[model samples]
Target: MLQKFGFTQYESQVYEAIFAQDQPLDATSIVNYSNVPKAKIYEVLNRLIDKGTVLTTMHGKKKLYMAVDLQSIILKIRADFEKDIEELKTYKIKRTFTDEHIWTLKDASSIASNIEQLIEEADSSILFLAWNEQMDKYRELLEQKEAEGVHVEVLAVGGLQSSLTHKYSLIPMIEDSKLEPSQLIIVDYAYLLFAGIEHDSWKAIKTTSKPIVKALTDYFYHDVALTQITKKYGDQLLQDEEIARLLARLIY
Candidate 1:
């Protein structure tokens, strides 16, 4: 485990051995307990001390070494990692050119993270369509954006019980959906992310392409409109044979 944090093998062994001891140990004692080569024991101890993972004390003419407190070391590591992340963020370049390429994203976690990022970056509005679970996952974020004056709208697969002004409709138009479960999101009229299960795996495509974004935006608008219309005239539409046939042909 210490090696994962960049500890050398001998340094890790020495530290563990010292930590396991009740008191500080001399180099010979550490080598005996850690089973590290006697020739390399002092070298490893010095490196560990330099790294602040080990401390030294002078007892008479003898130098003794002890492992630093585990919690202190862990906290230091975490602080360093966070500092690096903040510094890395400052290096991000603002793009001057329009990137119209569609990029594929795989797995549920990846898709969710990307969507959350897009939502967080929205300066104007967020238009989303997804299942109830997704709506639940992002409802707080959407509400936050709404509070910040971003026009937030959601079309949930289940119910429209949220603070955002939106619509909801069940997939009754298709009797049996052979299509995979999917989600749609448009952010600031610029970013578009469309995701669905494909071959039993989560797959998504994201893009900033103007044409594609406009096309999907229209699709989302029509979907919301249809859902609103269905909520009002659903029974009547289902009652008509011709309308029912056309509705049955409509699939995601």
Candidate 2:
């Protein structure tokens, strides 16, 4: 585990042994205390000295080594690892997709984290179809996007008899749904993420495909418009059931 910080086993043992003492030790003392091979002691010590983990001085004809401050080693190792990661990230960064492409996120266990990323990526608009369970799972991210000035509209479905709050305009569209408890997210009119938590795993398909996006957007708009019509005409339906049935049959 410590090897990633650039310490070999023998080198780590020698370096740690020196740290365990208040006084500096010669190589012979480090070898005995750390149980490292006596032959490998000076070689490991030299490497540690080069890494600034160990400091060397002369005591008459013999050499003594001391461990550097623990805090200094920690800071140096962290900076070195961060620099390495930045360098590695620069090689062949792939960040584009075709308009016809689709991507899938298949991890059900971390599905909330994936949704959080989608919410963060949204710039101007967000449309979501959420169930009560999904609202609980992703409440903070939804709130965050609302604060960021994205125009958020949601169609809330089953498991809750009422809305989570009235702060966001929501339409209760729960007669029946294939996407019940499944989440449909459209971000910035550019990307779509539809994810469902299944019995065995989470299955999701994300896309930038124009045809698919357009089709889903149309469906979303139709339902939203129908919800408005229902609210406006509900009281008028009390006078006659025939007209109500006809509108239901036509819209549904």
Candidate 3:
């Protein structure tokens, strides 16, 4: 069990003996009992004492040694381990929520390639909203998926009127709406991609988590009515949506 926590052999033996003993024993007694060298016993005892696994007392002219509160030591170790595990879980949650994987691309070609990879890996469906400029690169991939009988729903803004004439199905949102240059694609509720475009910078983030992806998908679905009306009338009707009405009812 000690080895499982990366304890060395000598350390494990010394600790085990100390833990098993009913009372503390001097180095000589420990040497006799443990069959470790007398010279090595002092070193081991000192280390154990420093680790709070043993204690020392004065016995007449010489110092007597004893194992410290073994139960307390074990409890402390268990509590520390539990704390460490909790911290690790919290860090994992933060990493998943932040979508820790990031990629920086310098040009449109790289961006197109990355988006294509996301599409190819998608297993269920693709949910996309973007501007007309970026659509050209994804157009062939989208059409290919449609040819393969995969469902694709795109919400595009600006100048899709002419391009909307094609056989491929498309959904139009408000014209010149803030194009979601920030791309998000969730696949099979298991994988996710979030891409962003700034004035001169571009980045993509990826993650895979069933629970988180499902939660995000559910949140979107839960607010679908609000999302549709918001897209239709822009942010000006913030006070008129069903969600707003519910909040108002609660507040009043």
Candidate 4:
């Protein structure tokens, strides 16, 4: 554990030997307790001092070394880790194009975890289309993202009540329509995730491909438009012969 933070074996031994004592120890005593070679003890002490893991002081004419407190070292390590993480968050790689790979996630657990991560990564907007059960699975995550100022819009099937801005799917009104419920989500226009239940198991695929993302985003937008149009002109649109014919040609 001590070596994990860049401590050499000799330095770690010397520090532990000194830390086990109630007071600081001189070079000779440190070498005796740590089993470090006499020739290497001073070098180890100097390195530990440079790392701020050990301190030095004079007791009369003899210099003594002491290990820093364990809690202090832990706090310093935590601070360094946090600083690195913050710096990493600001870094952006310059890439001319996105990778064209679509990753498949098998099983319900994998899909659920991936969707949760995508929702958490969303910084701007989340466009969702899903049935009640699928919507319920991620409803809290979507709500939390919305509270963090991410725009969440949903096109929901069945009667799933949520605080998000959503439109009801017309498939539910078809009465005779037999459509299996599925989930589609686009996050920040960068990620697309689609999943459905098959044979009582979940199958999902995710991608950052530009064409796929744009196609699905357009699909969600068109669905939203259709829902609004149907709500506004339900009877009138059905009465129009041409519109009725077009509606009949649509796949339920």
Candidate 5:
């Protein structure tokens, strides 16, 4: 849907008609074929043309409109979106971690897949601090890692009862906890993953270095102050507190 991209109803309809037709039509023809009002057809066509969804050419004294190739337009839209996202991510990295190189991921599936890959690559242990939401979604991945003999330590807003048939440990809720702001996963003392979701999509930033990972691991292990705060007021926090906490623990 182009709703999230800020397309209006008429604009979407015009664009869809053009995309479906795959051929250029004059404004009169568009009005007749699409059943849109004659008065509005020209406006729609001009708007679509401006947006690169339609192409116009002069045929005699009249202008003929043609649909831009749908595939090419879609690819261009996606490419532009990705480029903009990368620029935003670069700015965020510059402000947040000035010395670290950053990479951006654009989709939820990629975030899940990357988390799985990081877990699999762990040679020693996997340390995770997740909010309730992320734990619910990524529980299976953690279980799989545990099955592969990876030591898994998880701290979450709530407590887990049954320890699965794997090398997994869970810390129960602490009283008066202060929830963190993102999801975090550290792998084998070598890599870290920070992830978040917004508008039904997810993004992740990852880093790998033995020293950096080791320092993070130790910091997480010994940061009893943070641990205590998270334990106490974990539930009564932000809307995406769980996911944010998890990401923060892993990346920050």
Candidate 6:
């Protein structure tokens, strides 16, 4: 135990022997109690005395040694550690930017969980474009947002929420949207989540890029406009050269 305070093996044994004694121990007694070689007892005792852990007193021609308070030494070491902890805190600062880059979201359950978190955390608007499955999955969450006075807009087939929100069902894409099934959700114009169907599984990507948010909202608006155009012009929109080009490229 004394070795932890920088005492060597023989010095530690001698110090422990002195600590065990209620009265001081002379070099001969220290070597016998410590089980150390008699030739080495004076050398170890001298080192312990120099290190301030053991004090010596002259008894006739003999020197006797006793240990200092172990509790006081331990308390001093603890105070030094506490001082180091405070100094380390001076260099630690709160980070404003963290990992907001694009991240792969795996599995259907994980996708749903992240979408739920986005809805739960949104401070402003929500822009969503999805198919039947996602609409069924997150319907209650959307209703809760609406109840909280969040501006929620959804574009999907089976226009079930058009009455409660600024919702628009899909206006038939020029290239049929039924071929590839997917979901797109943007919240607060700061975060986006995309879930696309691939065979039996789903692949998703989440990001906090403002440019991506802007682009998605813009594309969603174009579809919203197209829905109005389809209502007004019907088949005649597919005939217009410019609208047809837009429909060809914009497959929402």
Clashes of each: 0, 0, 2, 0, 23, 0
**Model 2, range 1-252, lDDT digits (tens) per residue?**
447666788887887899999998998899899999988888888888889889999999999988999899999999988998987644442347666878887887556666666777677888877666676566666666777787777765533343333222233333555333467778777778888767757788888898898888777677566656666876786368786665554222
Cα-based TM-score, every candidate: 0.66, 0.60, 0.40, 0.66, 0.41, 0.55
lDDT of 2: 0.72
Candidate 6 positional error at 18, Å: 43
Q: What would the per-residue lDDT of candidate 1 be over residues 173-251, giving only the tens digit for each residue?
A: 5533453467899998999999988888889999999999999999888878777777788899989998877765442
Task: Give residue 40's lDDT in candidate 5 (0 to 100).
Answer: 83
Model 4 earns a TM-score of 0.66
Q: Sort all candidates by lDDT, best to worst.
A: 1, 4, 6, 2, 5, 3
Worst 10 residues of 6 by lDDT: 89-98
Please give the TM-score that candidate 1 achieves against the real structure. Answer: 0.66
Alpha-carbon lDDT, every model: 0.83, 0.72, 0.58, 0.82, 0.65, 0.76
Candidates 2 and 5 compared by TM-score, better number = 2
Q: What is the lDDT of residue 38 in candidate 4?
A: 99
TM-score of 3: 0.40
The RMSD of every model to the true structure, in order and in angstroms, is 5.4, 6.6, 17.8, 5.1, 14.4, 13.4
Give model 6 RMSD, 1 decimal.
13.4
In candidate 2, list every pair of residues with a backbone clash: none
lDDT of 6 at 210: 73
Q: Between candidates 4 and 6, name the one with more favorable lDDT.
A: 4
Off by over 4 Å in 4: 4-8, 35-56, 68-96, 133-150, 166-179, 229-252
